[model samples]
Target: MTQPPPPPNQPPGPPPGGFGAPQDPPPGGFGAPTPPPQQPPAQPPYGYPQQPQQPQYGYPQQEQPQQYGGYPAQPQQEQPPQYGYPNQPQQPVQPPYGYPTQPQYPQVPHQPVPGAPGGGRKLSAQLQIVIAAVVAVALLIGGGLWYANSGGGDEEPNAKGSSGAATGGGEDGGAGGLGGGGKEKVPADTKAKLAFQLPVPTVPDVTDVSGSWITDKAYVKTGVNSVVGYDLDKGSALWTLPLTGQVCGASRHMTADFKVPILFEATKRVAPRYFQPCTEVGLLDLTTGKLVWQTSITGGTAGDKKVSFSEVTLHGQTVAAGGLDGGAAFDLANGNPRWKPQANAGDCEDLGYGGGEGGLVAVRKCGSYDDPTVTVQNLDPLTGRPVSQYKMPPGVDFAAVVSTKPLVVAADVNDAADDGSGVSDFFSIDEKTGKLKAKITADSKRYAPRCRSTRVEGCTQVLVGNGRLYLPTEEHDGSTGEYGDETNEIVAFDLANGRMVPEKTDAGDRYTLIPLRMDGGNLIAYKWPPYDKGGQVVSIDGGTMKSTLLMENPSDKTTRTAETSFSSIGAEFRYGGGRLFIADTLISKTKASTSLYDKKYLAVAFSTAG
Candidate 1:
């Protein structure tokens, strides 16, 4: 079936003044009247990829640009093959991947510099301004996207019994699945003993176990329609606020911090699909379990029929949310409408978060008749005005943004004919100008509808931190379906000039080190211990790639391969407030088959004090 054409009078140009420029307010004051729904080009169902389509936005194709001196500079090195490159021939008589390289930098005796930390002179006003200016321009020009649509990519499961790394977690009913009445003390030899454990209604295993440093509290949105706050030190419930409707979305998306507000969706519609229910979003204070504010959402709110919210973030001082129909942002202090985007008079769907500094970035489908393109708009997070607009690469599908500061965009270049080279690539774009700077390509086969049946986990994964990009590769022969003696390693790339940071063969030698999240001074990584049974929490020095084992999880390792070989990388553990909450489970098994419950999750508290 042909896609209906866009409505008449909808020119493919910016509204009056460009983004951030003052313009006569539209009829509603905050936005133009929501344009009538236009027919968007046919799209792959929410979870699938499609063959090359007509360029929407009719954006002209441009060649990827070389890195400029303005960007951070790093030693130039050969780009490594993406993790899990497909059709890789068996190695013969060659150095193995991730071999160590001779030290490139001269090691000099440590010498204290003037105006350094503790007793070094502070930067001059001019130098500070210059540094700030560089950051502002980088934020505005934005880097390319990072981490392609993770939603569409299935997380490959670890060996049977190893549920997943102890990073991401979800709510589960208070059932002590361990043997005995579950009063067994955690092994004393464990590097970090359990500090506390609290139970709540079961949530999906993928839900994020979010914690707040400001309150020293861990939060879990239970399935029983409540957000429970627990004292991180004592594991006692400080407060429990009854929530409206189902908890807004997947637990993993719940973000909380002292600086940023927490946004969640509640639907009054018990059966949401048939009729548009009363969908509401609430911003809550992270320190106190109080409702900062609440408001009803328009449309299903950026997500498809089943899911309501695609993105909810606190950018600068604004809270932005996107839905299937469109997106809106409001001032953080008072929930006044900052701005809401007007959908083009064509069939367009809202893509979730893009990159911008002190602004919210959004993408919308706006394909021309023959070319498919997406309009990338950077909105003034404060006023909802378009700061700038650019187009995604032609022929590339939707770009899912992972970072906004050193903007990284992730997109998949499909192999229309299945020639076996479709790649899920990561790109950095100039936020101000929306130009592609760097591209990191990975194997798309790792993102098949079923990732692990034929491939390893983290093949389609990419992480950014400390001015470097982290890529995960299979450490063992994935064909064996066992990781008892094998391990994985993270390959780092300097983003400034897109050069490989030679891997340290000695670091993380016993396990696969997957950079999971960045918190405070540490790049929290999961040490997937051999045998897919136990796991370790390692703090990786972002600049040096040094590893420090923080704690070892005592989660039981069962040997049961459940229905699907797909699991989230962080489903077994959660980190917050310098603490690691490790849940004991049969790591090699699926959540449904695991013997662990949310009540049995244990916390290992590290010093929050410097």
Candidate 2:
């Protein structure tokens, strides 16, 4: 797991400038701000050999210019103009897959100091102007560089779960199932039309509004302090279940009957106690838009203190939650305590759990806080007892359960993976024997799966099914000759031996593909839109790895902008019954400078039936 870097030391006082107010400049003269220290060159992803630099396709190469002082200053010949912005320099450099290219520095002529051996000579006026212009260009390019932050479980008697499925209209209650079971409805026409959009609710500050689900009649989502079920086609409120406090966490898995688990505060936020602990757990019935039951437990050191949870998940009849304080479980149908926090001999506590139709798995931590030993266990859903346990390799302080049925775990062993994706290698274990089967090394530079370091079931864009693991390759240069046009593909690895599968699915030119979930034996995926196009949803045959488009959204400016606003990396996506839904997990207060006529949405839906 990657830990945030420690904060830089600060003077013992308020900021040099009071909050939101300007302050005096430093004592030293100020011209251009000091250049940041040069960072060490990035290394190749862990366990992979570094390849020699080579000229990449789609980019033109130019002769290298000699340094100023090393060779006598000679007349420079004019070079052919490069592509892209006017006067932009083009160097033939290849960035690591999925990573932004390092900024190229322009060589400048060295100036002689006043008392130096070369003696001082004033630069020509034209030369000074040229230098200033070069500096300005560099500054502009540096300022434009921005970075993106990229940030699941089991099982039981094979609970008939659906993968990315939602109920369609009609008396049969629509097709497709939720989480892992059932067949997805295939529409006659693949082209999709706009159905409706739900506007974002106004909030006083940045608020966590995570969690969403799709039912036979409604698209359910969490709001500021309530859960609202919206008409699937009309986008109007079907029903709203108000809560006393904000939702803190929700289970990704929905039961066969459409019930899900969630965590929330006991009371609404107010005054100095503006933030409340996420101590209450509840079961929500999406079909009825009601809280089936709500309850909390007393744990921690004193035994009679409320336990706060960071996440909750459901499996079979049990709904389990875990946090720093420990873990607790309850009957999913009714709010009855199944088990509470209990530390083992080594003071190990259940950090969290990953639950789905595949089964229930837990991540346990033991030993001293500074030197923790993490273990992954397959547990009996009803008994809260380990069926089989796999102790993580030494030096692995954290682990995430990606799948429980086949038993796959991901961890950044020895913290060698520098990327914040929280994974370096995957361990395939024998669920019955708790023995290691294969350790698959996923090079962070080449693979695109992301998992939150702190959340035991937070892995995304990665899937396990049919005895294989599917992952997206890091984005790379596309076939098109146009610069900045990138694409990626999905590849599979055999879970038995950890060998790469020959068959793969490509995302086509300018589009990046990511695995959404498994629909029976098929893999559902989303194709991220290019700048001028709308997004797409496709189903890849599990055996052939061939994709069939299910829905392609509108490419008009208005629709394209709205569709692209929800990033493929950060937003939640669901597609089934010829419909696709995209939603946000967080919403922030509108800025004062924003126009009133501009629209913001919590979710947008599209369908082929429209």
Candidate 3:
């Protein structure tokens, strides 16, 4: 038989609350009663006297209901308006047309008797009422089952032609709890025990996207040419220092030993060629939130534009800073001039990186961007003079500094002309002799260049720490001379010998690992959700390669929606004073009311304390 169509949409009625089973076969149709089966009288054992003959049995066992197909079909007969009861066995074929019909028995009310309404019980008016009540209960139960199996009242129609319950995202449309709203599931070990998170300060001109954390405070650059120190644990501003110069810039650095200096630079805010003749540098006493000492030194030549100070390293007792014009080293405690390294004539610019054993690295470009002749020099922190110098591979350009102390790690520009082939590498140089100690392996494939990553506000793909280098890259095929798939693999290489170390083979790929920093001998990183992949904080033991996933990315439904685009704000992740800070910036397709800043930023902090 054809099945019936489904019912139309309608507000559901009350829930079903009854129980029932299929009704028995209809009345009368039970079947013709069978005559009783004849049984021969038992003959006594041969010696016993024969028993007197017994009368024939009156009723034959009702012939087993005639089987139709596999399942038993209900007997055909009139159905009762309420509970349908099956027919009872008929009396023996009316013993030859009324041989004085066997005395008929009277039916009892509300009692079980054979072949009576409701199985021998006569249907008195009260009985009918009881049957109706039972039927009503059955209907109620069936209705309740229907309501439950259908979509409940909580769901809304999904835009994609389906439906889902509202996830109850938070203010930013991100789920509030750790694993709520379909966010990446947090591994048991690395789930965050948050210490605190401060409201991101609204700054007009944010000079630095990353924050520098000291004992209990973090220093950040504001838009209005100022640097502010905030209590990292309490989310309160401690102090603010304004830079008074034309093209001013500020940076904060904390050394391994906890020495911190707040560095500032600018040109005269005044007239002709408002040039930055000097950079004002100071060391701050974190506990008192006071500047221990401050001074300005004239090193690089002043010009029409502002002096750009790029790398700021706090090594031992020295503060090394460099800009377009030149670089300088100063006493960290008293701010006394150490040595000023000047750019030679025809040199494009001078840059500095932290050198091993408390030294410094200066990359001087002697050739223009087209010709590109670069020299790497290891400088003494105290003297600011070259301890050792070497030229980079012929046509290769200089990339960013990966490490400064104990061993200097730097990447060569990945352009075709630089390597003359498809390979790109990061080199570990011996600081004493400025010689290549090893050509570190970066990326996954042994022969391919590293993955060229777009600078995200807070994302860094390559990390140098302890004695190893961590690089995130896509697998490449050497024979084809082409990159393969998109599964980004993070490879760790020994800085000592530049050999790739084996990762735990049995640990199956969990999340995309991108190296972020080295903290307390642990390699800190952010993992992409294995399920819905993106930024998640994780820490890997540098030695074992074991990974632990920390805070998951806030549930961001928009990332999967067509209404918004995925982008990173390029805010650098920061780890210091036993805490990890993550900054995230995303743009929305929906418009918003006027605000001081065009966009908002999320700053989350995680702690290692028990």
Best by TM-score: 2
The deviation in Å at residue 530 for candidate 2 is 0.5
Best by lDDT: 2
lDDT of 2 by residue, 75-161 (tens): 111112111111112222454343223333343444665875668676666786688568646543333111100000121110111
Candidate 3 C-alpha lDDT tens digits along 1-610: 0000111122222212211111223333234222224422221221111111221110101112222112221211111112221222222223211011121111222546588765866567676667755644443222110001111112221212111111111112111221112222235454334555444444323224333454544634332344456667654677775555422332334655445665555433333432344466666555555567776554345444334454456666777666555566678767876655433334444554453334566665555657765555555555544455444544356644456554444453345324222235566655565444445423222222232121101114566654556655432222333433223345445444343433321112443445666655556665544334334566665555556656544334422111112122244466544455555332222344355333343454555434
lDDT of 1 by residue, 286-382 (tens): 5677777776543322333323454456666666655554555666676765554443434454445543242466655554436556555555455
Question: Which portions of model 2 miss their true places by more than 4 Å?
Answer: 1-182, 271-273, 343-345, 592-599
Q: What TM-score against the true fold does each predicted structure earn?
A: 0.57, 0.70, 0.53
Q: Considering lDDT, where higher is better, how would the candidates rank from best to worst?
A: 2, 3, 1
Span of ten consecutive residues with least summed lDDT in model 1: 166-175
Task: Between candidates 1 and 2, name the one with more favorable TM-score.
Answer: 2
lDDT of candidate 1?
A: 0.40
- Residue 222 in model 3: lDDT: 37
lDDT of each: 0.40, 0.66, 0.41
What C-alpha root-mean-square deviation, in Å, does candidate 1 show against the real structure?
20.0
